[model samples]
Target: MKRERDHQFECGICGAEDRYLLHNVRHRTPSYRRLCTNCLLKDHRGLFCPFCFSVYEEPLPIDRSMCNKCPSISHKPCIPSNYPHHTPFICPSCSSPNFSFFNPTTNGDSPSGRIIDRDSARALVAAAKIAAVSMTKAAAMAKVEAEKRVKEATYAKKRAREALERLAYLAAKEKEIMEGKGGGSNYNGLYLAPPPPPPPQITGKVEK
Candidate 1:
């Protein structure tokens, strides 16, 4: 145990890094995470014997043991016989059939329960907000892309219609020239007349 105390570790509650003794405050996990002096004295003051329902005093290290599932503490006499005597121990409250993971306490209002509940709730809310923001941005981008594709399609259709109209106009003019319907030669869709037979020869100016 003394060798374990030499290592620098972070407190389970406040996240302060320092050399401290180990305690199992974190829920669900069987392993014991480290706890600082401030957390043991300040936050975990309610740690008491679940069987006797009495708080342990100073010099409690000899008789007291922490639960592997939660921050619960127990005395030698309060400890159950079936429970194995080892580094990891489970208190009676945790071993009960009505045990709950989120609410680790009997009354659901314990100090550790409140911390876990509040943190879990805040995390869920933050995740929801981020997801909503991402979805909104994606929808907006999709709408813009859809509009751009529609505009491109409309422009392409208009260009195709204009090309068809130009082809129809040239075809009509070519047919007219080929059949001699214009009564003269047509140069590049332009019609020319025969020049009116040279204006009656215009001999010696006009007559009288």
Candidate 2:
């Protein structure tokens, strides 16, 4: 949608381009701050109300009319009794010049007065489906990549733990070798300590 009124702004939360909202709309939030639809729905608030930004909560009736000038929709209690049901309807903001923020479609892609051809509508639907499929594929790829990274990290940690255990075993063996000095500590297929002194050196010659 295009803004006609003077001021320009963005959503307080998401920083997406936005406009000054109605008092009722602003009050939907606890802080009465303005936000876009996606930002509001993160809290699971409401549906897509263009004027209120639906932040989504503000309940809107299913019975509604699409505006003639823009893609905005207005439902009961929100719109006037004189709202055209049969003919094209211009949304309140588009109809009124004095509104705090007035936005109507600048591009004539779907002007209410013009009915879209069947082929054009079909093409638009096809494009939307393609986009949705592409998004799903991208999300799947991201999830797979994240899982792979986690697996790799776990493997590295396991290898590190094994190495630490080996070092600890070697450290213990070194102490044992120093104390025993014989027939005790072996490491990596090698006897680390010298043989015991030849049975106290039998200095007095062998017995007859």
Candidate 3:
């Protein structure tokens, strides 16, 4: 018996395995290749489809649109057919108030009014990631600074309390010294009379 080979697929762009097969229609002879969902969407050069959360290379006959306010792109097939139509579509990603289909304007303007190419979008995402990291670092630095300030403040308060206690102790000591001097004594610049001279020596115990 012959063993059958398992058909395994991998995406050429992202090196993902077991992906969907996509047919390239650009060539005169159509060729098929496997593409992961991520690669497929990335090729579309837009945000994920709001309805399917998938990416597409181009707006197909099925339906496709872009949000004017954000990078969100959508496919009509992913949404209910009865979805209420609005003049400008609201972006489900960023919820931008403006939106439109990915179709060229009557004046031959480019499709998807926004001029974000795949490379540009990648750059933007990279920049955003860097900005986020910077912001996080700044916040951490700020927190550290705040903590340092708090510690310094606490130390200062402790010093102030200690100084006040020392002043109080000195005041108490001075008061005690003053009270001690109240008694008649030659202490603290005060003088007191000596005891009366010894009684006249009993000179002669004279005539008993």
TM-score of each: 0.33, 0.34, 0.36
Q: Residue 39's C-alpha lDDT in candidate 3?
A: 44
lDDT digits (tens) for residues 60-170 of candidate 1: 657677778777777777666776566677765556656322221244567533343553333333333333443565666668979999999999999999999999998
Q: Give the better candidate number (2 or 3) by lDDT.
A: 3
- Candidate 2 shows a clash count of 3
Q: For model 3, where is the 10-residue window of minimal lDDT?
A: 22-31
Q: What is the lDDT of residue 193 in candidate 2?
A: 63
- In the order shown, the candidates' Cα RMSDs to the true structure are 20.9, 15.7, 19.1
**Which lDDT tens digits does candidate 3 get at residues 8-68?**
3555465544422331211111233334433444443353555554433344335566666
In model 1, how large is the Cα lDDT of residue 12?
Answer: 70
Model 2: per-residue Cα lDDT over 1-208, one tens digit each: 3452322466556466644331112332222444443333322212233343322223646676666766556554556456544466666545655532222334456645344344334333333333344356566666897999999999999999999999999889787866666465566756656665676544667778
Which candidate do you rate higher for lDDT, 1 or 3? 1
- TM-score, candidate number 2: 0.34
- Cα lDDT for residue 21, model 2? 30
In model 3, the runs with Cα more than 4 Å from the true position are: 1-113, 183-208
Candidate numbers, best lDDT first, in rank order? 1, 3, 2
Candidate topping lDDT: 1
Candidate 1: where is the Cα deviation over 4 Å? Answer: 1-116, 181-208
